[model samples]
Target: MYTSFFLLSSRWSLPMMMSISHRGTGVAMSLGVSLFGLSALVLPGHFADYLDLIRSLSLGPVLIYSAKFALAFPLSFHTWNGIRHLAWDMGKGFKIPQVYQSGVLVLVLTVLSSVGIAAM
Candidate 1:
């Protein structure tokens, strides 16, 4: 029996994936920035104090890496997505093929940017 659910589809269509990534990154970036600002304002002591607190934990390598990823991912995604949006604003990449290509470009740029930020 043929049905809508039986149809094969591009499971990872470029536009679909990019749209979700855009929202995810936007929310993540907002939360990250807000939390960072809040921590600076609400923490009992200065930035060094928070650093000492984290340092005291003696976190394992995995934990450190996860923290780095969490911090880097949103910033990278938002930056890339913002660029994509700017292109749209300039009346570029409106076609489906160009949109998909640009999405790939955005992902690549985001990964590179994130890696660079994490390495810093």
Candidate 2:
């Protein structure tokens, strides 16, 4: 059963994959925000001090850009996918073709918005 499930997952349709990804990204974003909040409450110094500490590290451009993209991609993906889920709640976009189209659209928008925001 496990093997069959794995095989099916490996060949998952677009909607299936997107649904899984949406849940995964939601969990990731929740964890990220929770950790940030916890750190804010527990850490000694102010947020500015941490910002200064990061700046003091003198991270390279590539590393900085990668970090920004990392932060941006999940946010973008989650937000767009959320709108898709909302449409589902409204009894819309249930058709197979519409599902695939919206899934592709979400991916495109996610990449575009993530890159745009990360570039800022």
Candidate 3:
């Protein structure tokens, strides 16, 4: 019926995947931030209490760092890809080569930025 769509790795190009990911990350972050804010408002204690509960878990350093990276990843990716989209909006980087280059650049920067933020 062709009512559904999928992104097969070999079928979709880099820019196509990045565009899809950008939209997905944007929606995810928006929903996540909204829920977090709502939760904070509805929950009993202050934000520090929530932070204390998590810290008291004593999750090892590796796990803590991994969790930080997981939290940072979407924000990093969306920010870099949003910049790429802005460039596109300006009628720049429309060439196929430039598109691929920017896509790769965005991914690299996302990972690097995420890791850097996570390290802190």
Candidate 4:
């Protein structure tokens, strides 16, 4: 079963993979943001206190930047893919070639925007 699953997944085309990724990232971002907001509401300290706690860890700049990139990537991907989805909803870009082209465009835009946000 596992072998078959892996084989099937490996055979996914770019658009298929991007569609799956869009749903996965949407779920992840929703959960992450919800948990974060809930934590802020229930935590015993101000937001700056948590910020200070993280700062106290003294993690290196590289690690911090990597963390930022990790967080930004899903958000960027979801946002771009969502735009694609909206276009699809409007009866646009339904052709196979157009679908593939839009998928690639979304990926490129996602990467660029994610990196830009992470750099800050």
Candidate 5:
């Protein structure tokens, strides 16, 4: 059974992959936010102090933008995919084609929004 699972893994559909990604991203964001929040409260310095420290490094704009995009992509993907899930709950987009289209739509929107945000 386990061997079959691995052999068939490559055949997983987009919807299947997206469903797994959605759950994974949810867990990742939850852990990240929790850790970041705890650090903000428990650490000796203010959030702005941390910001100042990062600024002191004087990283180039390309690296800074890349970092911002990396941070933004997960949140963006999760948010858009979440809305897609909500539509599913409402009994819309149940057809196979609709499912794949919605998944692609979510990816496009995630990229565009993440880029727009990181550009700021």
Candidate 6:
């Protein structure tokens, strides 16, 4: 008699991937905010000093826009996922299909919101 206990490793399904991404992004965004808060408290200079420093760099518009997008992307993803969590907390959208659908929707919303914020 032969016995096999090994299980084949396979790629994760969409829902699993989404769930992991959501958690990862949430942790990253929380850390980002915490770091910002800590820096604000520890830094001696005022906010205007930093603002002026950046302004004086003379970087082109494309670089400025890219930086804006980088900053906004995490914020938008966190906001969208937070909404998803809120919906679940209210006992809504618990279905698997809804979860997957909302995952995709959140991503789209994140991209749109990030773009809009970066544009400003």
In order of appearance, the predictions have TM-scores of: 0.77, 0.87, 0.89, 0.87, 0.90, 0.78
Which candidate comes out best when scored by lDDT? 5
Tell me how far the alpha carbon of residue 78 in candidate 6 is from the true structure, in angstroms, after superposition: 1.6
lDDT of 2 by residue, 1-120 (tens): 999889977866888888898899989999999999999999998999999999999999889988999999999998999999999999999998999999999999999998899889
Clashing residue pairs for model 4: none
Residues forming the 10-long window of minimal summed lDDT in candidate 4: 7-16
Across 1-120, the per-residue lDDT of candidate 4 in tens digits comes to: 999889878867998889789889989999999999999999998999989999999999999999999999999999999999999999999999999999999999999999999999
Question: Candidate 6: minimum summed lDDT over ten consecutive residues — where?
Answer: 1-10
What TM-score does prediction 3 earn?
0.89
Off by over 4 Å in 5: 1-10
lDDT (C-alpha, whole model) for all candidates: 0.82, 0.93, 0.92, 0.94, 0.95, 0.86
Candidate 5 lDDT by residue in tens digits, 45-108: 7899899999999999999999999999999999999999999999999999999999999999
**Number of clashes found in candidate 3:** 0
TM-score of 1: 0.77
Worst 10 residues of 1 by lDDT: 1-10
How far residue 10's Cα lies from its native spot in candidate 3, in Å, is 6.2
- For residue 44, model 3's alpha carbon misses the true position, in angstroms, by 1.2
lDDT string, candidate 1, 1-120, tens digits: 456556554266778777888888788778878999988888787899778989999999778877787788777887888889999999998998899888888888888877777766
Among these predictions, the greatest TM-score belongs to 5
Clashing pairs in 6: none
